[model samples]
Target: MSIEYGEAQLLPGEKIAITTDTATEPFWKKAKERKLTACRCASCGHFRMPPTPYCPECQSREMSWPDLPGTATVFSFAICTRSPYSGEPLIYVPVVVDLDGAPGARLVSNLIGIKAEDVEIGMKVTVDWNPIQDDWLLPIFRPV
Candidate 1:
C-alpha cells in the first residue's frame, strides 16, 4: 500500500532519498525504527535539528543523539493550497513544531489526520511515522 497525504498518493517506487550524510545518518536511522532522535550538544546541552557535527551554539564537536518524546506544540503553520511540484490544487498543512522538553529545537513537518483549516498555532501535536520505504521514514504530525 502507498502512503496517502490527503489527495496526494506517494507510491512505493516514488520514494525519494531522505538524506545521505554521515552526521545526520543517526536521525534517519532512528526514524526507520519509529523513534524520534535529535542531536544534543555535549558542551552546552542544546538540541540541534538537521543534526550537525559541531554545535551551532557552543561550537562543540561532541554531540549525542537522544530519543525525543515526539510531542510538540505548533509554533507556527501554513496551509498550502497549491502543489509546488504538480501545480495541481491540493491541501496540506505544514507546521513548525516546538519540541517538548527541547527548548530550542523546532521541527518542520506536515500536519495530518485533520483538516487544514482546523490547524492553529499552539495546538498540541504528536509525531506519526509514514514508512514510505524499508529504510526511510517520514515524520508527520497529528493533533494530540
Candidate 2:
C-alpha cells in the first residue's frame, strides 16, 4: 500500500492514521472524498481548525461539519531548496493558508502550479486534489 510521488513513497495506510472519535472522523472522511470541511460549534457558532471534540470558545460538545469553498490566502510560506529526507534539490514552497470561510482557521499545505520565487504573502489560492489512491486524496493549493 505504497504510492510514489516524485522520488518519495507515500504509504497512505501506514502513514495516515484517523482517530476513531466521533468529532474527528468526518473531517478525514470528507477529505478522502475530495471535499474540505470544517468543524463548527453548535452552541456558540464558532469555527475551529484541527477539529476537536469540544469547542474551545464555549466548551460545547456539539459540533457540525460544514463544507468549505477551499479558497484561501497565503498567510506565510517557506521555500525548501533541498529535501531533508532524500537530500535532493527541491523547489517547493509550503504555505500556511488563512481559509476564507473560517476566520481564524489556517491550513498548512504545499503551493503548486507556480515557481517558489513567485509566491507572496496574501496571494489568492484555490484547492486542488492530488489522488494518492481511489479512496485517498491529498489537498493542494494553486494560484488563482
Candidate 3:
C-alpha cells in the first residue's frame, strides 16, 4: 500500500518505551524508530506485546525488551482509500506479522510502497526499519 502525502512522508511524534516508571513514553519512542520490541518475563520467559511491567503469564514484574524477527504474512488487511490527513487517497494495509524466532507472536504495522491489488493473503513479506530516532528503528513490512 502506497501513501503519497506530498512532502509529509515522515511520521510525526517522539517514540518511547512503556514501563511502570512511565506507562507510554518509551513505547512511542521505540515505534518512532521503526523497531518492534516486546517485553519478556525474566522468570517464565514469556513474551508480551505492548510491553508491560509485569508478566501476564507468570505474574512476574521483571521484564526486558528483546529484538524479534520482523518477517510475517498478510494475516489480514484492509484497503483504505480515504483519510482525514489532507484528504489524499492512501492505501493502508494493516498486517499481522509473525516473528521468525517468537512463534505465535505477531504485531500490526502498515505496509507501504505496494499496490492494493497486488497484496494477497498469506503472501511472504519482510520487515524494514524506519530510522526516525537514533536509539530505535520501527519495523515496517514490505513484499519479499
Q: Pick the candidate with the highest lDDT.
A: 1
| Candidate 2 lDDT score at position 94 | 76
Better structure of 2 and 3 per TM-score: 2
Error of 2 at 130 (Å): 2.4
Q: Tell me the tens digit of each residue's lDDT in model 2 across 55-136.
A: 9998999987778998999999877766555677656677899988887888887788876667789999998765654456
lDDT of each: 0.78, 0.75, 0.60
Global local distance difference test of model 2: 0.75
Q: Per-residue lDDT tens digits of candidate 1, residues 1-144? A: 633335322223234446458788888888888888788898899998877888988999887878889899999987777665677777777789998877788888888878666677999999988766455888888889
lDDT (C-alpha) at residue 39 in model 3 = 60
Comparing 2 and 3 on lDDT, the stronger one: 2
> What are the clash counts of all predictions, listed in order?
0, 0, 16
Q: State the lDDT of candidate 3 residue by residue for 56-131, as single tens digits.
A: 7888987665665556777776666655355666445666766565555566766665776667788878777654
Best-fitting candidate, measured by TM-score? 1
* Candidate 2 or 1, higher TM-score: 1
Candidate with more favorable, higher TM-score: 1 or 3:
1
lDDT of 3: 0.60
RMSD of each: 5.5, 6.7, 5.4
